[model samples]
Target: MINLFHFVLILTLIVVVISVAKIKDLLSAVILFAVYNLIMSLLWQQMRAPDVAITEAALGAGVTTVLLVAAISKTGRLEK
Candidate 1:
């Protein structure tokens, strides 16, 4: 049986993924992508992979999000 916390995390991941794809603003999508990564890190921790979780949190949510945001700042935030 799936625990409530895990189920909620999975559901949040799904929602964030969809939101990232559907969002039109580049900044907003990047933020949602960061959220997705954070949730994925939590799920990885729940699955007993601390290393993977740490990597995801640091690289995916931290570095990648900052890079994308910086790129968006240079390129502009709108999709088109």
Candidate 2:
């Protein structure tokens, strides 16, 4: 049986993925991508993969989000 916590995490991941794709603003999409990475990290941890979770949290949510945000700052936020 699927637990409520895992189900919620999975559901939130799906929502974030859709939001990232549907969002028009570059920064907003980056933020949503970071949120998606965070939820994925949590799910990985729940699956008993601490190393993968840590790597995803650090690289995906941390470095990648910062880099994307910086890129967006250099360019434009809107799609045009």
- At residue 78, what lDDT does model 1 achieve? 92
lDDT of 2 by residue, 9-47 (tens): 999999999999898988889989999999999999999
Instruction: List, residue by residue over 1-80, the lDDT tens digit for candidate 1.
Output: 68999999999999999999998988889989999999999999999999999999999999999999889888877988
Question: Could you tell me which residue pairs clash in candidate 1?
Answer: none
lDDT agreement with native, every candidate = 0.93, 0.94
Q: Against the true structure, whose lDDT is highest?
A: 2
TM-score of 2: 0.96
Task: List the candidates' TM-scores in order.
Answer: 0.96, 0.96
